[model samples]
Target: MALNDESLQELKAELLDELVKEVPSKTLLSLRLAETRSADIGEILEEMIEDDEELPAALSLLDILSAERAANVLGYLPGESQLEVVGKLDDSQVLKLLEEMGSDERADLFNLLSEDRREALLRRMAHREREDLKRLASYEEGTAGAIMTSDYVSIASGMTVSQAMMRVRQTAPDAETVYQLYILDSDGQLIGTMSLRQLMVARPGAIVDDIMIKDVISTRVDDAQEDVARIVAKYDLLALPVIDVDDRMVGIVTHDDAMDVAESEATEDFHKGMSIGQLEDGVSRVRLWSLYRKRVTWLVLLVFANLFSGAGIAYFEETIAAQVALVFFYRY
Candidate 1:
């Protein structure tokens, strides 16, 4: 059963009780979490890891999950929590998790590792995987390429409907979304697109070239993530194809990823509106000193500006003595 807020809290308490014991029951813990959602499990783990003593318990909980489930849950965790968990694991264990993770998420976690650790992990990866990780991680942090995943279905420009369906079947299992399919030329440049439904209903012998939509909606690799999110939302696209200057397909930003970008952009704008500087993490996770530093500058300026009002009031003391009512109607 899906856990509600109250049930999640109850589960947290029960898990903590079990975890604090000298001999924790892994079987019981597994049963408790068996039906819980990965996202909720991540939240419970995050709260547990906040206390240094509870970290081992958190790690144990993660261990109880299958690699794929653990990777999915890890993706839901805050950056710091993710770092903490991975720091406790060996290279091979982390690599296994990375293999199960989505391409974009794997790149993100890789980017968060320290320089030496990154090198160590890179050396262990196969050639194709290592190159892909480096390419994905090389994009500027706020660009489309940074958020996109290379897991997308693409068909050759000249394939028949039957061949396109076969290609879809082979690639769809690994694709972020199979609703939309890209058609690429011999040179790997994106030329057209079609939906899975369109291909399925077409005559088996029909040429994909004749059935595909000639114009494809796509974004550049260097495009701002905010802009990519906007395009995805505006078009109601399941995924927006990301390309390079030469129009070659590189990756696709899925709708969920785009929504994350939109939410982050909105948060940044909200912070700016409140005269607060950008925060690297959520407000609750930021250090006290950093929070003070972000807020103090504008607050100090406002304090000094208030002094001018005091000065003006002093300047008008005699006038106020003659007309006390003027103070009540003061505009400044």
Candidate 2:
């Protein structure tokens, strides 16, 4: 059932009460929590921390969730809360949570951490994950590489439907999404795409290339996330492949991630429209100077532009006085 505001608040209170109990109603709570949305659960944790009360209870909430789900909820929390909640957890806890986080999300969170904390956390992650994290985190913010996840389903174009299906099955567990599959050449270049539905219905003996759509919509890793989102939205794609300078496939930005990019871009535009600086973090958490830095340039430019216009008018005042009679007939 869809929960109203009052019901959601009650659910949050119930969870907080359960979490704060001496023994903790872990089992009973899980049964109830399973019915709640991750967004709502995140909201509960956020509500509990508005006054910074019940942090331990919030930690308990995080603990009850599996690593992946915890990461999902963590992504929903504000940056400061994310750091605070992670600070309460041990390194092992943090490691497990980060391991299960999406590649893009892990990079975003890792970028926010202190150097010492970053190194410590990186040390605990497996080698593959650590390497992937570095590669993704190295990309400039707002770029496709920074937002794309490396965990995508890729299949050889020559593989038969059966073989491709087997590969999809094997990769699904680790893939961020398998609903849309990329077809790659031997050199790891994305050549086309095939939907999971099409793959399933194709003849078992049919080659993947025969069924794959050759006109794939994609973006470069260095392209802006906004550009990637636009391509996905225009093409009604579930995912957009990321290619390198050499046209080799490296990752994909899933539809959900694209939607997030779209929202962020729209919000940024709104902020700019209001003449407020677009903040990377929420308004509550940004430093006074940081806000000033982002806003001052635009204000200063506007001031100078107006000053130039005023000066030009002042300089033309004598001419205007002489032409006062002409002003009335200056329609042309």
Candidate 3:
């Protein structure tokens, strides 16, 4: 059974209490932290921020995790917490964390950095990593390129199932997903695809092209992310391939990222429905003037619309008074 929020909150309290105790059992704290979910840890960190106390202990606990785990947890934290926490990390530690992050997430964090800080950080990364960041960051915020991650497995068409299997095994550790494998041509065009199940059951000597699905479902790099999410949902896909104008495979948008995009789009629509502007953060966190700007424009237009409506009614008053039934019907 899954733990309820109450249980998770209790666990958080226990960890915080341990942090305060004399001779704090680092071993126990470490074990508990390991057992907690990254999202829950992020929530705990958020609570620490809200209290303005226990913040040091929460930050200290973050340092105890491995760079990869820390990065994962950090990704779940709010934007404000992310900047503060990242600022506390040493240069090397920050680099390690960024390297372990998914390309889309790394791009998001990189975009948040100031120009000078971004340049400084870029200098520390390897040539390939720096280039990847630059490419990923170039995409518009709500496009497929902005959400897609490059950590996907791909192989050439001529490779046999045995060879493909070997390649997948070699690359799976670094890939974000391995369930769906892409088959590419020499020119790096996505030619076909195969699921892990098909690969597992096929004869070792069988060529990938023979067993792969030639009808691939993919989205363009510049496609709206909501449209990409619709594709994934419509096809019941685990991952959808992203392509360039030339039909070459660029990256894959995993199901999880698709869902996030869906949620974000829905939230934006919800704001529009309520006559409020689209806001990625909670209303409490938004600047008061910014909120006014989003709403006041619509409100002002509505006032004019109401004024026009009143004017039209006044113009028709004599006609309405002659036939009161017309007024009732029109109002109805």
Candidate 4:
């Protein structure tokens, strides 16, 4: 039975009260007993977190929750809390949690994990999921293919609208989005595209070839993600198709994924340019000695460069003293 609004609100209030008391264990037990469904947990947590400032307690409660339950809760948490909870998860747990995340979010999280942890998690993941990750990870970190999802709706040109709808219905649950359908030829080359609205309005006997738009905008597999974002932004596209060397439709870069790529690339570049080490949350939380060690090499190199500049200045001291008036004139 669906939970009534009043009951849900009451349960939420109760949970919040317990959380405020700093009694996480009791709050966790109460939340579990409330029988709040997994699908509803993220929404509930979002509301609770917005109204309450006691996030540490809520995160502690999250630790006791199932992987799916914790994953859902983490998604609703504030950004810092999301990273914190993900950092606390074990490799197996991280893999399971990632399975529930969108491709772009998953890739971002993967980049934050330690190399060994990432490899171990990948090894434990399902074969197909591993393949998808491998394909995506193979792309340069700032490219469109790095962030695009392989899961999309596609149909053959020979299919009737009714047949295409049937296929969509069968695959809808697995698809990231179904607003647009790509039409491919027998060789799996992208030929055209059609929107869900078009499919709905067309006759059942209408062939996809007749409905699909022949002129389509697309990205190459190796295209820079920034360029993809510019193209999408220029055209105001919901998703940009990605094609291989043979013009075979490989996948698509969704708007949300493109946004993530932009954000990740921007963050990484900012850190690099600032001469600061990339601090994956876990890395940031390491011991002071470890943190210092990570930074020492860069500091040493910078120090030597500065020393060279000072020595050059010292070597020209006699020339400077002989031309002291020139120094004043040069300063002017």
**Top-lDDT structure, candidate number:** 1
Relative to the true structure, candidate 3 reaches a TM of: 0.88
Candidate with top TM-score is 1
Give the poorly placed runs of model 1, Cα more than 4 Å off: 20-25, 280-293, 313-332
Off by over 4 Å in 4: 1-17, 20-58, 61-83, 259-332
Candidate 1 C-alpha lDDT tens digits along 95-192:
99998899999999999999999999999999999999999999999999999999999999899999999999999888889999999999999999
How many clashing residue pairs, candidate 4? 0
**Tens digit of lDDT per residue, candidate 3, span 79-162?**
777887777666777788899888878888888877987888899999999998999899998899999998899999899999
Ranked by lDDT, the better of candidates 3 and 4 is 3
Candidate 2 matches the true fold with a TM-score of 0.83
lDDT string, candidate 2, 284-326, tens digits: 7678888787788888999998899678667877887888774
The order by descending lDDT is: 1, 3, 2, 4
TM-score of each: 0.90, 0.83, 0.88, 0.63
Alpha carbon lDDT of each predicted model: 0.91, 0.86, 0.87, 0.74
Pairs that clash in candidate 1 = none
Model 2, backbone clash pairs (residues 3+ apart or across chains), number: 0
RMSD of each: 2.9, 4.3, 2.9, 8.3
